[model samples]
Target: MTTPRTRMPAAARRTSILVAAAEVFGQRGYAAATTDAIAQLAGISQAYVIRSFGSKEALFIATAEHVLDLVTDAFRTAIAEADDTRRIEPLLGAAYVRLAADRGALVTLLHLFTLGQDPRIGPIARAGFLRILAILREEAGLSMERATAFLGNGMLVSTILGLQLPAESEDPATAELLEATFRENTPLVRELFGGRDLDG
Candidate 1:
């Protein structure tokens, strides 16, 4: 029932809105970002933004959720399809490394944590993480607690990597060095999973 003309405009507007939100959310963070500013960046009025998205928080939530969805899909697909279980850590590492290249996701995450302890965002982010952990746990046959813990640690390391490195720092030697460090630490992951051969 929708014509291309109508659909095209809607799609364009949505992209414009998201792009504006990413810029504001990246620079000032979620809590500090304002709808007025986002609208200004988008070259639209605040009312127009509110009509499209309910509020600044809603916009941030959409942006964060969008990035998380991509991460979840790419991560699960890459790890699940790989022939070797030993590649899980490195695969996950590579996923985050790729995500870090997306300036929007990195900035969104940095701003998300900066927001004061709110029960709303916490559950959403937590649920997304738990879902990923559940996938890893179910696939890897790891216990719930162990899976969550191990994935938590992995995410922490990935966050640190995202924060410390620039997006353009695409050095094969650096990646190899990190991968080697990950390989060397297989014993630690094994210990975390109740001494299982996760690296196998």
Candidate 2:
């Protein structure tokens, strides 16, 4: 006997598609990634994926925004859960490290950064970067210098994680870079690498 198909709520189904799209777009750049792959991964029909998001471009944009939301949401959470006596920088850095453990989302955001030259995605990418900067500046009360420093470190984390460099910890250069870059979050990043899901 065949098992019955599960029915998900519309919101849940949309999120599911976006999740699959992120994985596809993250692994394959937007120009190369297709809705069919996303549909197959999502266990939905390509027509349904189009019906849900209108088109591939729209779906890519949605997925990009979704991952940006994940990053910003983590920052907001760090801000909210910050210890009164402890510095917010380390807390925020740890939060970024934990969230960056999701290789798909991190790579997707990096892909989005590259698409900043595309007419369709450029403005959105710039706006997303500024949005994160604003949050660090206005909400987190970080000065421009501190925010820049954090962003620089975030880029390093993204690059290291994207390249799976931690797996090369035995190498002197990679080990030194990861050690200096992650510092206290080194163990956390190494442990969670390819181990955690963003949606979790």
Candidate 3:
């Protein structure tokens, strides 16, 4: 026997759809993902999914915005919690590492970034990216160089996750490179990626 699934409020249902959309879009990319897949993941009808977001492109834009909000909130919280101004970069980096465990939003945002040539999505992606950079510079009070370095390291982390490099434990060179690359954040990386192989 199984319990019946309770109905969600409209707002909650919308959010649920977005969460499912993020996971689907993250795995399949915007071009490949379909509302039917998202609806299946969300345990809803395709009609409801379409009604919630209008279209796949609109849903993707919403998903991108949602991901940006998550990232910006994480940075804001990290900045607020930092006791030492000098430690802000590491704090923010740690925040991102923690978030990367979820993988959906982060990977989806990465997919969004590759659409830089799209007249519609390109501006949204570029603006969202620049917004994060702005937060690091203005809100986090990091200098331009430091902010660039932080973002560069973040991009590297994204790549590592995207490539499933951390799961290549048998490759000593990969292990060594990751160890050196993450340095102080190596433990977090291990925790996030340890013993996990990429999905087929």
Q: State every prediction's TM-score relative to the real structure.
A: 0.66, 0.91, 0.93
Estimate the lDDT of model 3: 0.87
- Candidate whose lDDT is highest: 3
| Candidate topping TM-score | 3
RMSD each, Å: 9.4, 3.2, 2.4
Sort all candidates by TM-score, best to worst. Answer: 3, 2, 1
Tell me the whole-model lDDT of each prediction, alpha carbons only.
0.64, 0.85, 0.87
- The better candidate by TM-score, 1 or 2, is 2
Over the stretch 1-200, how does candidate 2's per-residue lDDT look in tens digits? 99997789999999999899988887887889999999999998999999988999999889989998998999999899887625687888888877766666777899889988899988989999999999999989998998999899889888888877777777788778888998887787667763434333
Q: What's the C-alpha lDDT at position 160 in model 3?
A: 86
* Residue 35 lDDT (model 3): 97
How many pairs of residues collide in each model? Answer: 0, 0, 0
Task: Please tell me which model should have the higher TM-score, number 1 or number 3.
Answer: 3
Give the residue spans of candidate 3 off by over 4 A. 1-6, 198-200
